[model samples]
Target: MAYDLEEQEKLEALKAWWERYGTLATAVVVVVALAVAGWSGWRAYQGYRANQAMGYFEALEDAARGVNGPGGADAATRIKAASDTLRSEYAGTAYASRGVLVAAQALEEKKDYAGAQRELEWLVARKDQSTLQPVARLRLAGLLLDQKQYDQALAQLNNPPAAFAALFADRRGDILAAQGKRDDARAAWQSALAAMPANAALKQIIQLKLDALSGA
Candidate 1:
């Protein structure tokens, strides 16, 4: 009977210790678990938003590319509106970058070079190391070339990403040709031809340019 009483006293002491620290331990565990869950949920929401924005931009591009009628003014206007909406809602997303390209294309077709230039400039400012950036630079250089800004066009073609090297070389050739630098133009065309795939028709075009330069 005495041993039993001693054991009960030890149990009571343990209970008191637990009562002193149990609430704090539980609160710490709950906070940590909730923090993990909240972080995961936030990441999921960001990914979902990014995907939704991409889908909407894809739809807008499809609409822009589809042929409507002889006069495409209405279609062009719709494309511009869609692109503007994307820029406003998803400005920080890759979809917004894509929308800039679409809007610039439409504006170019409409002969609104100023508007197209604005879109291209916006893209240039925001362009990163992603696929969109090189493509945007290529298009922007083309616009600059149209304005006879040879040096600016060449600057854009320089140090392009690996995926865009051939196209960049071809653009450089075009710029050089415009400047009457026949030898440099030929060299650029040859570089483009060397980089281009054997099956691509663009290689043949570059070869022809090289031959013509040699002939002259």
Candidate 2:
């Protein structure tokens, strides 16, 4: 009888504690469960988007290689369509930037300068940070140089990333040389040559440019 009384008291105490805290404990568990599920759902959605973007990128590459057909115009159309889809729907993905670059190159090869420029401009205008922005800007500068838009081309070279510093300087030399600014071109080439690694093959090419400028 004494043992039975002790067990009954313990049960009463547990019931009182649950009555005081059970609702709070249950709410806490529910919140944590929901957060975990939401995070998992977000990760799964990102994976799905990445896979879809990859499929389109592959299609873009295949069309660029003329795998779908023989007609040049048709190939260009397909390439443009694929690239546009990636740019519009998967702009957050790395594949979108790469797709645009490939499309730009193909269009440029076909002498579709306007179309290529438009694609490049679209990439440049994106606010999202991307490693490929420098490359796109460099290419755009080159295109502008080809068109003899001297001032506009120079604008694109501002504040390049460190790894691209030498390339930017070299292209600056090209633009200045075209403008008949021999002294400025020489200085820019000298900067590029100094920035390059000793073993870089491009070092020789830059040095040759410098030598030719000096001789001139």
Best-fitting candidate, scored by lDDT: 2
User: Over the full model, what C-alpha lDDT does candidate 1 score relative to the true structure?
Assistant: 0.82
TM-score of 1: 0.77
- Candidate 1, residues 1-216: lDDT per residue as tens digits? 355887889989988988999899899999999999999999999999898888778866876675245646776767767777777788888889988888788778777777787788777777462768788789988988898988987887778888889999999998899899998988888888888888998988888888778888
Alpha-carbon TM-score of each model against the true structure = 0.77, 0.90
Model 2's alpha-carbon lDDT is 0.89
Segments in model 2 whose C-alpha atoms lie over 4 Å from true places: 1-13, 67-69
Lowest lDDT 10-residue stretch of candidate 1: 63-72
lDDT of 2 by residue, 71-107 (tens): 7788888889999899999999999999999988888
Model 2: colliding residue pairs: none
- Residue 78 CA error for candidate 1 (Å)? 2.9
Each model's lDDT comes to 0.82, 0.89
- Candidate 1: regions farther than 4 A off: 1-24, 51-59, 66-71, 196-201
Scored against the true structure, residue 81 in model 1 reaches a CA lDDT of: 73
